[model samples]
Target: MRFKIIFPTGYQVADILNDNIDINVVLENGDVFFGTLFTISNLDYLLAISQEPFFYASDLLIVKDLSKKNIRAAIESLVSGSIELAFTKIRSTWSNESGSDSFDTIIDMC
Candidate 1:
């Protein structure tokens, strides 16, 4: 799945671009997507009436809703910058181990 969020102002866009902030997408399901994906300047000029900067996360895993605790854990792991570690733990239990091997795989997925 591909998800995108628009920054209403230039300040927000500049901060995201300059700081190279990692985007963490916690779906309603347990699956989490984390990546640095905001370099394009004119990705959606026509779609955005204001032409604000848009961040798009692609190739995310699709799953059902997760428990509240699991959602919190996913958020914590992504924010802590231990995505690989988190995925390593999750992959052991996750049926689709093929998708959650390394950070490079995560990047490629995103």
Candidate 2:
């Protein structure tokens, strides 16, 4: 008997994310940062932690089929101390096809 091996779509998504991609982020100081998006898995976005104008880093989740406004709002919510709320909103629209983690590592720096 032969068995068919099937893989989750998240695996594909994660593989794609391994490449460098462009992304934008607005800082708490009303400044915007531009940089590449990369990840081994969809769980973390890996945003920047540098004060340099060109330095960009963030570990955002790769939400599927979301509007630009929604993405902005989600990240902005984080600046407002609403982590779980933002995750909830993003998670509601996610199909779980990507393997990105919802938690953040920013606190680890402190």
RMSD of model 1, in Å?
A: 13.7
Clashes of 2: 13
Q: TM-score for each prediction?
A: 0.23, 0.26
- lDDT by residue for model 2 over 21-97, one digit each (tens)? 33433332223233333443432332243345453345344443233343344345454664443222212311112
Clash pairs (backbone) in predicted model 1: none
- Against the true structure, whose TM-score is highest? 2
- Per residue, candidate 1 scores C-alpha lDDT tens digits across 17-99 of 22322344433234454443332333343236555565444422211223233334434545456455432222122112475
lDDT of 2: 0.32
- Give the Cα error of residue 101 in candidate 2, in Å: 33
- Report every candidate's CA lDDT: 0.34, 0.32
